[model samples]
Target: MRKIIVSAAAAALLASGSVAFAAVKHTTGTIKTFDATAMSLVLDDGSSFTLPKTFKDPGLQVGEKVRVSWEMSGKNKVAEAVKIAK
Candidate 1:
């Protein structure tokens, strides 16, 4: 009985760890391009994600190298930030 309980507990921990360490949405890259109409960004990592159209005014531009962090919803991802490094 004790062995069975221990195995179940270990399985639960493994399952939770996978979810808790889900892939991070942060990446560092230069803005390859931006289209106001499209509200999309092309990063140097060869990956891209769209910014929330409702976000406050953007203070970034193409060619600026910045760190980006984002959040995911369903199959879509939204840019949570775009910051320049000192």
Candidate 2:
């Protein structure tokens, strides 16, 4: 009974941690610049984010609307996903 209770508590803690880690913010704006060499992008709103090397191309181009999902990595904003917004 004690082991079962401990296991349940551990599972709950792990679930909460995952939720916290998955809490990424979204930004929507026009693509001001896309530096493929640097793997980063800047929005017209003056927001800049670093992209993960594994990020797939979303057919990005300047002057196009896009939505970016990102999270804070250290002192930098790291992009998790990007999508072209109609």
Writing each residue's lDDT as its tens digit, candidate 1 over 17-75 gives 98765555787888888666787878876767787877553577788888888867667
TM-score of each: 0.65, 0.75
Candidate 1 Cα errors over 4 Å, as ranges: 1-4, 71-77
Where is model 1 poorest over a 10-residue stretch in terms of lDDT?
A: 51-60
Candidate 2 has which clashing residue pairs, if any? none
Angstrom error at residue 30, model 2:
0.4
lDDT (0 to 1) per candidate: 0.76, 0.94
Error of 1 at 62 (Å): 0.7
